[model samples]
Structure formats: structure tokens, C-alpha cells
Target chain A: MIKHLAAASLLLTTACLAIGPAAAADPGFTDTEILIGDVEPLTGPPALLGVAASIGHKIAIAEANAAGGINGRKIKYVLEDDGYVTARTIQGVKKVIDVDKVFAMLGISGSGQSIAVMPVLEKSGIPTVIDVAPVKFLWEPARKNVFVVGQSYEEGIVHLVNFLADKNPGRKWGLITQDDDYGITVRDGFDTVVKAKKLNVVYSGNYKKGQQDFSSDMLQLKDAGAEVFLAGGIIGENIAMMKELEKLGIKPVTGIFWPGRIEPVLKLMGPAGDGIYAVDYVEPFAGAAGKAFLEKAKPLVSEAEFKGINRYTMTGYAAAKVLIAAIERCGKQPTWACTISELEKTKNVETGVMAPISFGPGVRFSNQKLQIMQADTATLSFKPVD
Target chain B: MQYLVQLLISGLAIGAIYGLIAMGFAVIYKSTGLVNFAQGEMTMITAYIAWTISTTVSGNVFVVAAGAILAAVLLGLIIERLVMRPMLGEPVFATVMVTIGLAVILRSAINFIWDAYPHGLDIGIGRGIVHLGSIGVRTGQIAVIVTLLLLLTAIWAFFRYSKVGVAMRAVAADDRTALLMGISATRVHALAWAASSVIAGIGGVFFALSYDLSPAMFQLGLKAFPATILGGLDAVLGSGLGGLLIGITENLAGGYLGSGMKEVAGFAMIIVVLMVRPFGIFGERDIERV
Candidate 1:
């Protein structure tokens, strides 16, 4: 009777072992190759930014492959350009999943674009590394697979408020923000900081998304004694404001958010962009570390592509680093289940750009600690604040 | 008082550009009895063309502006021949729809060719700030304002004294009567389109230099819509004055009341004007049509 029972248990164990790996295996992963996917904007209005992010991820993927591959298994990356459209982004991600059969996705930029692909991503059971789009609650529920890689908008704004408090205290403040969800979020973020710190925000004005003239608004802010002006808008609005302000001869101390893109501002503002303050998630091609990373990444990309890297590039690089590390931890033949488990175990993963990433059960997004900088129009360069 | 001075300087600069564009709208409507909704898009496209020429060919601003004007004139004539002429006797709605389509086509074509990035162009003008007591103005701002005044005078003179301009007005008043009087209505319409396009070209260059050129710049049409209604759709002088009034009122409301108050104030003023003076400040009551 004892011999019979032992033989029965051994049969059940064999059945369970056969069913486990078969069920957990995602489509593209095999014994020797792991396929990854990405959706970035390569063309359209924001193409400059999109191209930079795509190149950054491509470099990281190439580097990971060159370094003996991930756990001796090669990593293949397939990218589709979404052109900053939410609908196109959804279709691109679907193609990557259905056609390319990638194991995971990384470096999906744009706020509305990500929201477009969320259902497909969640349904596929493929983990996504958030390289950009710092809207809170994307990873708040600890969805077991999704992870964010940038500082929250609130934290970025908090750093700005903290800096302002230190530089010029007891001064009336004003805000000039665009009218949109992102802009509203920025205003709210700054308002929270101001109210919490008991600072005065004298005047606040909201402009439509594509407004050109700000002379009237600026004049009002000046009359209201707004010594410090905080602009929460895109590069287009910022350029318009600068032009109008110059015409009105009212150059109050100003601070603008990173606008998630830089080339637009640099190209438009040119010489008029002197003495502007901005906060960023990562250093924008500054310092020794930044140059070193560029040197390593330069040969991997085209010369024309080098000018494209900005804050998003760093986020892409960080996402790639985290993905590579997770793939490496999943052993030679990584399955979706094993890779996701490894990703969840990420601790102190070093991204060449941005801050060190350490994500676990409760901490799936990076801390919002940021550095502020001043733009030098003469050099078209950014310098770290003392 | 200082605030008022600042508002005046800024308002006049913006108002000048609007006035020029509004005149273009009135010119086309007065001759053809159809509103060219694509006026703003034409301005944007021509400005971008001028910008491309200025940047790539390193051409003079006058050369670029003149080229843009000639191009717009050709475009306007072609639009009349292809789109407007076919539906000459058709419902006004059809013509309106054609103009809308033209606007969309022009905007999309610009996006496809140039992409969506906004480019800053100098257009051979300086942004040198000039202080007039408490008021401050840039060189480009002053130039734009002066250019508007010059354009208005030239247009008035042409319509008042020039034989061709008088013939065009006769055609606008009664096409059948003008045809009987040995005036070719088609030729008159073509001339009106060409002149309107030239005015649009000027407005385009000034607007682009004053504000960064972008795809969204076409939305300036919405603001101009109120200006057109307030100025009288077919009255050129009224449209120009209406644009100035709207610009100044919107600026003052935005400055003193709140940012949100600007659009509100614009509509309110338009409503009051339409109710009190349905023909507008300078518009003829006999020409009033819903």
C-alpha cells in the first residue's frame, strides 16, 4: 500500500512540473532570445523629442547585447513610431505585441499616448517600464508588473518652490500656466507647495493651450507686483511669453518647467532665452558623467541624433537599464513570470543618467528629488545651481 | 496709468496684425459674398513659406514678403477658379464648406511638409525696445502698427480713386448690373481675391515674427471670427476698427479682471454691439444679413 501511494504522488508531481513553464511562457521569449518592444514618437510635431528617446533606448539595448547579452541570451528590441498620437500609439503597441511578440515594453512617452495602450498592456501580462509620462497613480496600485521611472510632477514643482523660497523670500509670486490637465496639475502642485509653506502667490493666469500673446497677462502680473513669475506651459507658449514680455519691457524673475522637450525652446527663443530658470529630472548633457555617457552612446548612434538627447533620453536609458538588469536576473531561458518577478526585485539599479533606481513592493516609482538649473543663452548650455 | 500705457502698446501691436487680416476677410466677402474661412490658414502657410525662404535662401525680408504675396495671390485665384467658380450659382453653404475644406487642406499640408515644430524667424526686423514714457514698444511692434496704417490708406485710395477698384465695387453691389455695364464679374472677383491674398501675406509675416510660428497659430481664426462679426462681414473699414477694439478690450480684460475674462469680454462686447447696432459701428444697416 505504501509503495502504491509513493508511485501515485510521483505521477502528480510530474504532471504539475509539465504544466507550469508552458502556461507562464510569453510569446517571443525562447531559450536563446528575449524580444523587447517600444513605442516612441519618431515623426510629427514632437518628433525631435521622440527621436532622442528612441535613440537612447536603442543604445542601451545595443550595449546590453554587446556585453555578452543578458544572461547569455540575446535581447532583440522592436520599436514603432506613434507620432505623438494616442490612437496610433495604441495600434503600434498592439502590433508589437501581436506581430513582434516582445517579452516587454519600455520608453513609451506622452501622457495621453500611454493611457491609450494601458488596456492592451494589462491584458497581455507583459510588464512595462515607464520611461516618461510622470502622471501619478500609473504605478500607485502596485499592479505587480508596471513601474515608473521619473519623478512625479508634484515633486518636480516642489523642488522649484523650495529653490524659490531660498533665493527670494517674502516676495509676491505669480503663475502663468496653460489650460490643460498637465498645466492644471502643475498649478496645483505649486499651489500646494505655496499654501503649505505659507508663501504668497499674488497673481495667477491661465492661457489657452495655443495662445500667442501674453502682453496683457504680463502687464497684469507686473501691476499686481508679481516679482517672481512661474510659467507652466509648453515651449510654444514659453516662446510667445518671452516675445511679449520683451515687447512690454517687463522681465520679472522667471521660472519655467522643463516642458518635457528642449529643442523647441532653444530653436525658437535663441538669444532671447537668457537668464531663464528650469527644473529637470536629469542633467541635460552637462557635467563629466553626462559627457562620459554620451561618449559611450555616441558611437552607437548617428551624429545627427546626438543633439536630440534631453531629459527623456535619460529616462529611456534608465528604463533600458532596469529592463536589462531584470532580463539578466531571469536566467538564460527567461519566461514572462520569471522576468516580472526579477523586475519586482530590483534594488539600487544604476542608471547612467538620472538618479539610482530602487524599486520593490511599495516603491515602484523613483523618488521625485530633482535639480534646478539656469539656461545660458550665450552658450546654449545649462549650469547646475550652487 | 502705467498699466494702461503698457496695455495700449501691446494691444496696438496685436491689433495691427488682426486689422490687416480682417481687411483680407472683408475684401473677399465684399466681392464674392462668401466668407473665406481659410484666411488664417493662408496667413500661416504664407508665413511659413516666407520663413523657409528667409532661412534657407537667406533672402531679404522684402523679397520673401513679396514672394509670399505673389504666391498667395496665385493660390487665391486658383482657389476661386477651381472651388468657388464651379459653385458660383450654388447655395452659399456649399461655398462656405469649400472654404472650410481649403482651410483644413492648407493646415494639414503645412504640417506634413514642415512638421509641427514652431520655428522662430527674424524676418529682417529688430526687437529693439523703445520706451515712450511709461509705455514700451519693440521695433517690430512699431513696424507692424505702421504697416497696418499704411495698408489701410493704400486700400482706401485704391477703392476710392482707382477705376478698376470702382469697377470691382460695382460688381460686388450687383453682379448682373455690373455684367450689363461691361464689367466682367469673374475678373472682378479674381482681382478681389488677389488683393485680399496680398493683405493676408502682410498679416502673416507680421504675426509670425511677433509670435513663434506653429500649427496651432491657425486657431487665431476664432478670435478673428468675433472681430469679423463686430466689424460687419463685408465692410473693410469696420472690420479693421473692429479688430482694434476687440484686441484692446481683450487685453484690458485679461490684464485687470482675469485671464478667463478675456474671451468672455470679447463675446459680451460683440453681443452688445450686435444687439444695439446690428450693422456694427461703421457697417450699413441695409447690408445687414444673418
Candidate 2:
């Protein structure tokens, strides 16, 4: 009879554990670790981009934990490599959501990978902060749980066009774009501005994204007599264009989208890279904000990684800060629903590098465009341009 | 007319690369009755090898280039000994699949050696522009065309005159008969693989100099597949000519029609040629025995 009574009590306790604690424990009291999950492509062509972004998140979370933690609860991040494959991203999200049961996800690197994780995140009611997706469409539809930290490529292009008009007047324009939605979005951005400003568009061409040759395209563009150039493509295409341009001795003022760092271009172009300009949303270990973030972040991220982190890192760091703040607003004992609700109420939260984020009703893009910085050859550094 | 001439010149240069790759395919197909799916990867690897040697050796461009080709030939012999030789009696499908697997392994290995960043070699081919009054061509493009001519001639002479080339042809004609005639079919097959890789190496060097090098360089094989089909898989000279035709047509289509139509034009050309001349413009027609 005594043995039967002990078994019944044990069964009741197991049931209670499965059902979650009856009432919200005091804030930070219930769980051993506050688990967060992230997916980044640590392998594949864009691995460097994902690696830097992941490291940025780790640094920020580590710093938060070191400061007695957010709301006195330690933050633990579980990361997986998606390798930029959509199928793998789905598996990564499922593993994080079902197996790890992360409190939330902080930063996921690619647009396609983020989209791959969307269904799982929505079903699980997991709050997610995107580090790299810039398309407004990604956040628009009132997903209720998703927030984007990067500015749309369209907005970045508009900013670049306006800057170009002011800096170099009467330069006949041309665009070399990839044949894809992202490239089309950039082209549309440039076209809208060209019409508004009455800028002359001498030539335009589109090549596939992963193409290795641009000789024919470059020759045609040169023949069309285009002066100022706008290139909307990934890093590889841009490198091909730059090489061809150097070979042809054509020096057009170029506006290229996010093409990683300056080293490979410099290595390939040698001194020909003089006066060539690129715009980035994050400063490269430059200015007070970047330096401060680096100093604080350096210890947490691997030492091998500190020097190479770019704009993507800043986005990751910013996402982590916002996520922690949202967690804090949930008070003691945070539920996914309540944490998301508190996150929606945030306004103008400063993240040091990006523009302030405000996520109220109907505004999901966290930052409203950060300052575009120009690469300064004199210092071999980046500084905010006027 | 001026625009047309310019397009023609540009197309021929692009086609020359296709022709070289198609020729490599043709040579291997004739000898072994197998399509080397790794042909593009072969070019990519050889180019990268040349790139490394050129960068590290600090010698004249010609010397470095010759050394790179020699290295590629040696590497080709090694690849045959290791990968292709063991699969001599395998089914056609199995052999093709093996080549596909080899291609993937080669591509990944190259990626490991050099990260996916695009690189271009500076081979001191002058950057001067040569203008035909109304039309312009860069020295780089001219060099590509010249190299193609020289390669085609060398291969032509090699097959026509060399005793080993005759044996290779005999093996390609009928492996059983060639074996009965006391020629080692395996030796011919090894020589074919070695020769194809050499072509691949030269093609890679010029390709890097003309365009740039990346993991995507492997896509050049996809572009050349059409050339092989259009030229007749067994026709070496046709490979070169078809590459030029495709290149020129692709350019004209891109320039005159639209970029979206360029791929369509290539496919359309192939379809039309296949419908009219099923054996290809130069390929030998197959006759089945009753």
C-alpha cells in the first residue's frame, strides 16, 4: 500500500512537469538557462557573411550575460549552420524549435533561410529578429512575430542615388544588374530616382547571379557610352565587373551593393581601386560607435573573427540588444506571447551602430536606415560621408 | 553594320572558350565513348593551378604558362591512374556517373584550396585596344582568338601525323578490334584523358586571363555542353566552330534581342540544327547492324 502511494505521487509530479509550472515563477527563477537559437550559413559561398553575423550575436549575448545577465537571468544561444540551403534551414529551425525549445531566435542570416524558418516560427509563436533580410515584404504582412533589422535594398539604393546626384553631377548613368528579384528591386529603385531627377540612363544590362564572365556585357555598356555606373549584383559578379573594367581601362564611378570587404578588390585591382567607392551600412571598426562595440564584443567572439566582421555583425549585435530588452519587458517569467507584445511597444531604442528601432503597431522594420559610410583609401578605413 | 561587326568579333572570342571545352569533350567521347562531366571542373582546377604557379613563381608569363600546362598534363596522368583506370569495364551509365562524382570532388577540393572569392590573373597580356575604325577589339580578345587557332591546328596535326594518335583513333573506332590488333585500349584511354586535361589547362589559363576565376567557372561546362551537341560529339574541328557560332549568336541575341533571349537563342539554334542535321553539322551518322 505504501509503495502504490509513492508511485501515484511520482506520476502526478511528472504530469505537472510536462504541463509547465502552474504559475509564472519570479522573473528569471524557473529555468536553468534562457535558451535562444540562431541559424547562420557557416559553410558555402556566403559563409563569411553568416560567420561574422553569428559572432556578433554571440559577443552581444556574452556581454549581456557578463553584466549579471538580462533581468539577472543568463542568456544562452544555440547556433546551427544552415549552409545557405533552404532545406537545411527548415531542419535547423525544426531542431531549434522542437528539440532545443529556445525561448526565442535572435539572428538568422539569409533572406531565403529566414523565409524557410517562417512556418515553424509562426507555428511555435517564436519571436524572431532577422539580421540580413532587407525586403520590406519580408516583414510586411503583419506576421505578428517577425522583425527585420536591416534596411531594404531599395531604400539603400535610393540613398545611394541621391548621394551620387549630389556628388557627381552630369554623369551619364548605366546599371549592371543581376537577373533576379533582388537585382530588379535595386534597378527599380534607381529607375524611380532617374525619372524623378531626370537623370540620363544611357545603358542597362542584366546577367544571371552566379555568372563568371562579363566581357560582352561590359563591352556593350562601354560602347553605349555610359559614364556613372550602378551595379546591383552579389560579390562575385561585382569582382568580375571590376576586373573587366580594369582590363578595358574604363573608369566609371561605381555604386555597388554589399560586396563584403575591400581586401579582395584591392588584391585584384591593385592601385586601380583608387577613387572607387562602395557604401556600407556598418562602419568597419571605425568611428566611436564601431570601436566601442568592438572593444566590448572582442572578448566574446573568436579573436580570428574580430578583424573581418562587417555591417552584418552590427545587425546581429543590434538584434541581440533588442531581444534582451524585449525579454526584460516581460518582467519575471516571460511567455512567447507576452515577450512579443512587449517588443511591439518598443520605440527608438538606440543600438549604437544602426538607426534607432521602433516596433509599434504596423512598423516591423526595426531600424530606419543607418548612415552610409564611404571607404577612405587614405586611412584604408571607412568613415561616414556627408 | 558596325554594331554587327562588333558583335561578331565579341561573339567569336566567347565562343573560342566554348570550342576548347567542346573539343575536350569531343576528344574524350571519340576515344572512350563517354562524356567527361568533369570537363569544366578540369578547366577550373587547371586554371587555379596556373593562377597559383603564376603568382608564386614570379617568372615571365610565357614560362609560367608553359609550366602550368606541363603540370596539368602530369596531373591528368595521375587522375587517370587513380580514378578512371579502375572503371574501364564499367557500364556507360556508371562511367558517366563516376565522372559526375569526380567533378563534384574536384570542385569542392578547389573551393577548399581557394575560398569562393573570384580571382583574376595578370598575365601581362597588354591592355591596349585595337580599333577597326568603326569597330573595337581588346588585345585580350585577340589573344583568345589566336590561342584558339593555334590549339585547333596543333590538335589537327597531332591526330593526322602522330603514331600514338593513330593508335588512339584505332581504339576509338573499335576497342575490341583494337585489342585484337595488339594495341592496349587502356593505354589509348589514358592518353585521351591526359590530352583532354591539357586542353582543359590551356583553356583554363586563357579563360582566367579573359574573364575571371571562381567556383562558378565550372558553369562553363554547361555552356559548352550545347557546343558539343551542336558540333557533333565526335567532331573535334566542329567543336571549335560550334563554340564560335554559339558564342557569336549568344552575343548578338543579348545585344539585339534581349538578355533573357540569349539562352533561348542558344537552345533554339541547337534545336534547329538537330532537326535538320541529326548527326550534327560534322558528326558521323551511326548505322545500327541488323
Q: Candidate 1, residues B227-266: lDDT per residue as tens digits? A: 7778998788778777788888888888888887776777
Clashing pairs in 2: A27-A332
The DockQ-based CAPRI class assigned to model 2 is acceptable
Residues A1-386, model 2: lDDT tens digits: 99999999999988878765435321223454688889887665666577668877887888888886767788888998777788888898888877887788876757767766778777777888887666766687768888777777777788888778778788888887877777788898898899888898888888876666566677667777888888676766676676666655687887766644444544554444545555656655668887888787777777666754666778788888888889888866787777788788878888887668888886677656645555555555556765
Q: Give the CA lDDT, 0 to 100, for residue A117 in model 2.
A: 73
Interface RMSD (C-alpha) of each candidate?
A: 2.6, 2.9
- Which regions of candidate 1 deviate over 4 angstroms? A1-52, A58-103, A107-109, A260-272, A292-309, A324-335, B74-105, B108-111, B163-194, B277-290
List RMSD in Å for every model shown.
4.8, 4.3
For A1-386, candidate 1 gives per-residue lDDT tens digits of 99999999999889888987775556877667888899887664466566667777888988888887787778788988787788889999999999998988896858768766777888888878877777776776666677788887777777887787678888889898778778878888898888888878888898876667888887777778887778777777788777666666667777888663364575566665677788887766656667778888888777756656666777788888888888778776667777778777887777768767877766667664588888777766666785
The C-alpha TM-scores of every prediction are: 0.85, 0.85
Docking class of 1: acceptable
TM-score of chain A of 1: 0.90
Q: Model 1 misses residue B77 by how many Å? A: 4.7
